[model samples]
Target: MTSNSDTPASGFLPPRWFIRAAWKTHKALYRWSGGRFGLRTPRPDRYGLAYLTTVGRRSGVDRSVMIGYFEDGDGIVTMAMNGWGAPEPAWWLNLQAQPEATLDLAGGTTVPVVGRRAEGEERDRLWERWRELDDGLDGYAARRPTETAVVVLDPRTD
Candidate 1:
């Protein structure tokens, strides 16, 4: 098996310990919040407690991930990866392959959102808006080499 060092530096290759710790913490928090409040609160700050379910590009299995979200007009936008200076997350690639995704909000609302990759002015605007809400995003941007793209999830009414 190829080690993380062999992988591209741009992508997220957190240490094994870090990954385990994060997973454990996430799972614990998810269980606690879910049991107590009937909600999954992976990310409490920035009003982030939603899960994005995406279809795997190759595996064809549905994958779910907890992520941070911000309201952008009528749509909801989420950063596709970690703010710790990693490459675009796998979920973004999955969305690229399949734009249709399901979002489970904290309020027990599950909605189908059409994912669109934002670029140019739209991307810039959203990036700015994200930074304004989360200052850590600024540091995350500084660590990344490539400009991150925004995944705009337009809520489907139908």
Candidate 2:
């Protein structure tokens, strides 16, 4: 069986365990700090972190996670890459089951949003935007067996 280390991009990324631990720690800090840290606005050449809450597909409970995103016009865009692992992120799955969700931005602002996958030219465009942010974006993405989803979060009108 092939391991992550076998992937060409593995050299540029930290171990999967370390990546997962960092995520957990980031979330814990966000929660413990009362939203004071762990999230920020996206800059021109970098992605920002945000907190997203989606309903569990099966349990119907709210599940929250920290995601990297960037502002696109008035909407937000993120990827469904699970630490560059093979499985889809649970938050992405939940968004698929229920597109309506909420995003907690930095500065304690919350916005209701609807999630969807980008496609065709839209996907290409957004993916390019991400590429400009991280030089190793494609490398990390290639580590996965499948294409990482480009998720767009638009403000909910209703």
Candidate 3:
């Protein structure tokens, strides 16, 4: 846990309550507007937001979340930061249990996708791309114990 003016002195993630509140707000607004607001669409500045639906590992039900993503080749790349940082996101775990999922892009298109983790050099490359977008990438990552999983969702061929 490194500390500096640019990073949190305690090397902790932003308050969990704050992140949870923000998540609820984002989800609510995103749904209320049919994805017009709250991390939706390809902004000129940010990459974009998508609603990801996956099969719950235990419940056998559909679970959805709004996540930030960038295009990678023909696939969509995202990070499993979980906002709070330390604990892994349940969405990522669900995807691990079942990679086949659907991604709704800005309330426009819903596409079937198969999720896989980008590893080694590929992971490094993708992480760098995120770093380019967000300067605090490394610091946010440091708040978490485990290495952040870089996930790529490729369109399902069949």
Specify the highest-lDDT model's number: 2
**Residues forming the 10-long window of minimal summed lDDT in candidate 3:** 1-10
Off by over 4 Å in 1: 1-20, 31-45, 83-85
How big is the positional error of residue 60 in model 1, measured in Å on the Cα after superposition? 0.6
- TM-scores, all candidates, are 0.74, 0.93, 0.88
Clash totals in order: 0, 0, 0
Pairs that clash in candidate 1:
none
lDDT of 2 by residue, 1-158 (tens): 44445454352678899999999999999999999989999889779999999999999999999999999988899999989899999999999999999999998899999999999999999999988887778878877899999999999988
How would you encode candidate 1's per-residue C-alpha lDDT over 1-158 as one tens digit per residue? Answer: 43233333323355646864775576467556762432443332454556788999999999876666777777888776553545677778898999899987776788899899888999999897776666556544556677677778998877
Each candidate's lDDT (Cα)?
0.70, 0.92, 0.84
Q: Scored by Cα lDDT, where does model 1 land? A: 0.70
Ranking by lDDT: 2, 3, 1
Give the winner by TM-score.
2
Candidate 3 achieves a global lDDT of 0.84
